[model samples]
Target: MFKRIITLVILVPVAIVLILLSVANRQTVTLAFNPFEPSDPVLSQSAPLFVFLFAALMLGMIIGSLATWFNQGKHRSRARNKAQEAVKWHSEADRQKAKATELARSSTLPPPAESAPRG
Candidate 1:
């Protein structure tokens, strides 16, 4: 519930701002990829300014996500290795426990014969 409230607080304003920005910048603009030609380009696109802004935003998010994932590779590897080691240690402990239990069972002495109570 707290998380939802926080998300609403943050996202609602961002959404409103993005909506306003898109509405305000609805004019069509041409994006040229060719640096050689000033007026005409081989690779170009005409779209709303918001479209480019949103595309760039999405691209940046994707790039940042990839970079973060790549940067944490070592930490992820270490966590995996530690998990495997923990499993190995746990299994070893279980095996030792079972062996000890078996030893205790096998080494147990028989019950003494019953005797009458003396005054």
Candidate 2:
């Protein structure tokens, strides 16, 4: 459920952008980075540039979110390991307690005579 909501949140903005772009019919100007002169015809336009920059920004945001998600995965694994260790320790303690009880009962019995009767 939570995953579905997060997916929707991410997609909503992208959908809105596409809708807006389709509705508007305007040209965009883009700056060309060259020492001599602007050559590329596509770079000479402005509308495409705005869309390109917005797309880049959105891509960066998605990448950052993925990085955070992977980091959280590491912490989650650490927590799981600790929980397993705790369970193992509890079982070991129970086993030791049982062994101690058995030993105590056995020790209560009388011991055989260590030496024969003296002359």
Candidate 3:
């Protein structure tokens, strides 16, 4: 229930802003790919202003994500090392537990006599 509320709270505002951006930037704009040929463009295409805006937004997000990931390389490395160490410790513990069980079974013990019911 709390998750749903949080999702709605964040989603509603973002959806409204994106819708407004798309509506406001609906004008058609031409993009020229051929920078050398300024007078006679060999490659050019017209797109909606919203397309450019969305493209820029997507590009910025991708760059930011990559930069963040790259910057946290040390943290990732540390996490991996810690996980490996945990696995090693767990295996050692399991081996010790098995050895203990084996030693307990190896010990000579007399069987218990049957007890009569008191009831």
Candidate 4:
């Protein structure tokens, strides 16, 4: 939820800016060149205004996602490693506890030589 809000907060203004810029410059822009066509079209007319704005928005989203992933990559791996280590340590401790219980049960009787001599 927070992430979504943050994304919207940052992207909305950028999208608005791009849209406004496109709208303002629409008149000055011309259709894009087309080699297939006998005559190249004006650049602005070539692509719809919405298409340009959508492309820019998508580009921004991709950059934002990549940046986020890159930034979190190390921390994610580190957390995973820590969890694995914790599991390993717990299992080792369990094994040690089992060994201790077994030792206790098996050592109830003393060695014959260590037993008190008969009166």
Best of the candidates, lDDT: 1
* lDDT tens readout by residue for model 1, 79-100: 9999999999999999999999
* Candidate 3: tens digits of C-alpha lDDT, residues 24-71: 989898777788875454587688988988898999999999999999
- Relative to the true structure, candidate 3 reaches a TM of 0.73
Model 4, position 62, has a per-residue lDDT of 100
Please, what are the lDDT tens digits per residue for candidate 2 over residues 40-118? 7654545555577667789999999999999899899999999999999999999999999999998897887789878
Error of 1 at 84 (Å): 0.5
Q: With candidate 3 superimposed using the best TM-score fit, by how many Å does residue 3's alpha carbon deviate from the native? A: 4.4
lDDT string for model 4 (1-119, tens) is: 99999999999998888778777755433345565663554422545655666677799999999999999999999999999999999999999999999999998886567768789
In model 1, which regions exceed 4 Å deviation? 116-119
In what order do the candidates fall by TM-score, top score first?
1, 3, 4, 2
Candidate 3 lDDT (Cα, 0 to 1): 0.91
Model 2 regions lying over 4 Å from their true place: 1-14, 25-28, 31-50, 86-119
**Model 2 lDDT, full chain set:** 0.81
Measured against the true structure, the TM-scores of the candidates, in listed sequence, are 0.90, 0.38, 0.73, 0.52
lDDT (CA) for every model shown?
0.96, 0.81, 0.91, 0.79
Q: After superposing candidate 3, which stretches have Cα over 4 Å from the reference?
A: 31-45, 109-119
- Model 2 lowest lDDT segment of ten: 41-50
C-alpha RMSD of candidate 1: 1.8
Q: Select the stronger candidate by lDDT from 2 and 3.
A: 3
Instruction: List, in order, the clash count of every candidate structure.
Output: 0, 7, 0, 8
